[model samples]
Target: MILNARSSYSRLLLMVVLITVIVSGSSRAIVHAAVNVPDNIRVAFFINLGANKYQSLTSVATLQSTDGMNLIWRDPQFSLPAGNVAAGNSVRFAVDGYRALVLETADLNAAIAVLKKIQASSSAAFVTRLTKSGKPVYQVTEGTYSSAAGAKTALTKWTGSGVATGVQTLISARVAGPWAVETGPYSSAYEAEIAADQLGSAGLDSFVALKPREGALEYVLRVGQEQNESTLPALQEAVAAAGGLNVRIPAAGESYALIRHDMTLNGNANKPVDFYAIPAGSGAVLRADPAGAGGINLLERSKRTYRGSMEVSVLNQSLAVVNEVDYEQYLYSVVGTEIGAKWPLEAQKAQAVAARSYALSSGMGYNIAHVVDTTLSQAYFGIASENAMAIEGVNQTAGEVLTSQGKVINAVFSANAGGITADNATEIWEGDDSFLTAGAESPDDGPQKGLLDWYYVALSSGQAGYIRSDLLADSGQKHISGAKYLKATAEGIAVRSKPQVVASVEPIARIGSGTLVVELDKVPENTDYSWIEGPVTPEVLLASINKRAKPQITGPLRTLEVTKTGPSGRATEVKANGVTVDVGVSDNLRGALNGLKSTLFTIEETGRYSILNGQGDQVDSSGQIGSLKIIGGDGTASSVTDPNLYVMDGKGNLRAGTTAPAFNFLGKGYGHGLGMSQWGARGLAEQGYDYQYILKYYYKNVLIEKDA
Candidate 1:
């Protein structure tokens, strides 16, 4: 019977995998006698494509149809149980050469009814069998055809003529005709009748059938005789509206009949088949024309050549094309993009193994595709990105993978870590992965060492802060003075300050522009061991601190201090104003401070204060250095530093002027200091350490083994 698009979809023979394996292992040998790897994985290349809303790949591509569906190499064979084919009017189709567009349902009675309905429209035949789910299903078609294209044309032309509601679209690999629909897999015949009765009461036809599963008989209430889509909806809707009835449409495309082609004395009965349309030499050709200048142009820019079968299907409203490829071959482009193709051989091999492990361990075909061609999973650029070194890496590793506790590991890696790697829970999202722990691998010299000495200043307040030395501005001067500038003393050049420096004034306070006027040679050439920041104004400091910290800092930002640190001397906790914040996990602290480089820093205010008198009304009057009055002469103050000691205002009160100080930060390192540091790896490689050693230094207790 003809069905609408939705009804035809409902009539689809849903093919689901059912695997049962029994494995045995001993010290002498390991046995995998029952293991079954699927011959082909079905990926939804497209779903509901275009304004025309076609469902099958053949429908969209206008490929040829056949008397029987093209069978995969592993399909079980069967024949139509009844109808014209059973009545000797139909010829048995050769499994290899011919195919048919069959409507499949999980119920045997429904299959017979559908066959009768199709026969009423035109002369058609059908067959029946049991699905892996133990449900009786049916397969039926119009006539057997030798070529797929001719069959497709016949199905399309016949369906378009408005004879059937919907054209049969699913190409069956079986050489049978009868189609069936399944209803109930009830525990008892009584339960099956209850379901059948409910459908009968709702003006739907149904019956009870028995099937065997795992050595037990199951009673199923088979529903509907016609495969036409238009008739079932109203019945289903009525049953649903009636309520209290456990009626459900059979799952779409969930059942397939296993058909076998039989040979007769008149030579081989079935024609030879191509199985899954797989070409022998170059693999299955696809829409991507090999004759084109650069093969297929992906996303309109990158042209790529792929070694695998390509299948196109509809997804949502657009087309989804999947490249079905071997797992190892998929790594060629991945390794080349994840790490440069020119990387050291050992490093590339390490990367290849890691990528392979990740791919094998990951569940592919999630979004109807094996893996997206992006870094969201692994960076892939097809054949265009592959190189000799990448191929060598793949070859060397072969089927190798890093496994922990008998399962493949998820080897996650990142770029440079400044110097040290952080714990997995500490650097990435909170998770205690023992494999990812903090360790020091990067050298503290060379260009790597130059990452520390950079510095920044509050452009408005002259408050200075430190960033990575490599990120510093080119050619700028900060004319530092007061306690920051060194002064020659009896003991040597030292930071000039009061005896009780912390208690007396702003710690590390200075005046003028806090620039690094010292010669470049003063800081070692290839070393960037430290960074400094801020004499920042209250407003800017508050904004920056509140942005990164939780519970938003209240009041004016008064102080910022490193309250706690991790093993690498990186700040794990900090205090903004009076609020103590924990930044121990991930890169929370770095993100909090905008771009703090790393969290190893100390806080300092940038201005000095004068000692006040005991009365709290005036500057100190004692005859001491930096006091308001340095000396007394004729009851008057005199000193080299005292400019206006006792200037009387109009009210005869002594007044003096003072300056306010801003805040500053001094720090070290860059990033969260987690995982493998790319720069550190390079340095280690330069120092004769191999990639395996580098990986071991960062990730602990992982065994690199080849998959059997």
Candidate 2:
């Protein structure tokens, strides 16, 4: 019995060891990777969508509320609720039966004059442009009244020379129409605008609306904005009187309702609603609620899905798209996108804590908004980045935030740390945070050997792609020196069908070592922790940097060198072509040298590479040239850029190319190299560390606790 028990114990111990090995190794899942409400604190992200993708005015937008949208009128004082837009989802309550008083005018300038008179008479006036019978028309409307009888009473007083004496206007009720002189249902605003321009050249005023089309978005361009014409017969009569191109008025169920700051979109799945809000007080918001659980807020443009309700409103005339949800719930997407959707749960948990602290503390968005949806405020890509692991990480670390001296710390982290993190926030940003101190993971002073998973490589033909780090045989040189030029073990090394990555990708090109190449960067699978980006001359570097400089580099920029460095060898100040770039902000120094990837790089003046001829003597350039072909993963080889020269002998015998890059920037550690290193956290997590341990390791003297 003792012998049998011993044998069983040994088997159990082996099983545990095997599980640990599997968990620590190659665990990346093969997945290719809200604000508003006073009762509960939330975050609002100003996402650039549709036409607002570039402009401040969001002329077109798609808003979906999960529980149907309701309209609420503020007290007559017109005090905009806390965040400029309306606060609290009106799903709770809405007082209905409000009628809008609209006055129609043929000329826009005349409408503007009439609108001024209405507002002067104690009514909030808004101007709207609409298309009636293929003709452009303008309307100036009063905000709203509790009853139609009340509206009519005001309309009579206004018509009796109270608003404007000789305006030549018609009084209209319910300003949206059931028909329009329409064009198309384009897939994107860009495409619709192109088509709209074609119609404009033929003398037609055009407008576009981003609306729902069969479960997706349709950028619909019409002859004019929808305006007040309640019936089809009335529209037909007006079109006949104007007489141009025959209007193809859509059939019934096609409805367009619009107001500058007030919108009413009842749950008519068939109708396309165009809702905008004129800033009555500060800004106006209109929320569209979805049908049910099956309803989607925004489908990440194409393939992504998110939880919670989507609030749509106009801020600065741009459609401000905000995803409103519980604060902890928002982190599901935040943690996933910030780190990895399929990374080990503990690593993502650390990310969740850091992201929460940073977002809550940095109020770097539109008013009442805590953060933006970019690296400018940490990646928050909504539902597309969320996964099972992300959900777990966020839920497991719910409300947990890192705080220092009773305030939430700005836990800024980057891709890699080289080996040790930066001394403090001063290395990257302006001020220094006591907790953002250096923390070393490994004993090495730099990137560990063989730790790199992917390499930014140029082919023998000088084309760019990535190769697995393991496939590269060492060129008998340390990476801390000049530049990394790897030698392949065999001829015809296969490149990935996917650029800048390897692992489970298909093989693309079969090029041999006869091609001289430059390995620009050595990054891990999930972090741009190490990179190299130049050969740019002082003049070229000066041109790229001067565009962003205030005390710009003026004279002939001939000399460039780092004058001062931080604790992590990150450049704090630099002499750019003899000009001292000692600005108050350290980040400017990072952008000085051709906008380098990071400041922790050594400048290497290259172009002295020696090539061997058949006679065993080395020369600067090769005497004979070899055949070369460039292959692309895009399946179109002709699309890639190339030079008109070749010199390598096409086999690995040290034959240099005709021309080599001039100044190679050999660098390590991406980002500002401050605070926690994301890849370093990932490595520690894989080594069986918990979230709390990882957080304390990178951050100095910080307490991990629930904020509320």
Candidate with the greatest TM-score versus the true structure = 2
Q: After the best TM-score superposition of candidate 2, give how far the Cα of residue 411 lies from its true spot, in angstroms.
A: 2.1
The worst-scoring run of ten residues by lDDT in candidate 1 lies at: 81-90
lDDT, candidate 2, 185-282, per-residue tens = 66565676566555544444455543333444345654532333344454444433444234455553342222222222234322223334322123
Top-lDDT candidate index: 2
**Candidate 1 regions off by >4 Å?**
1-295, 300-325, 364-378, 381-385, 425-428, 444-562, 580-585, 588-674
lDDT of each: 0.45, 0.55
Total clashing pairs for each candidate: 73, 20
**Tens digits of lDDT, candidate 1, 1-708:** 778998666556332111112222212122223222223222223333445533322211211111221211211132121111211111221111223445555444444555556556553243433232323334444543434555566567544554334434233332322122455467665676566655555544345543333444455544543323455666566655643245566553322221222111123323211111111111212222122222222322233555444443234423345556567767887787776655677777767767776666555534555455555456777777889998998887777766666666667665455456655554345577676657664652334342333222222222222222332233443333211221111221112121111344443334232333221112222223344444456677667667656678895554566776666666667776558854446357766665566655566543222354446554422223243343365676644352212233445333222234355556555445555554565567667766667667766677666545
Cα lDDT over the full model 1: 0.45
Superposed by TM-score, candidate 1 places the C-alpha of residue 414 at a distance from the truth, in angstroms, of 1.9
Cα RMSDs, all models: 24.9, 17.1
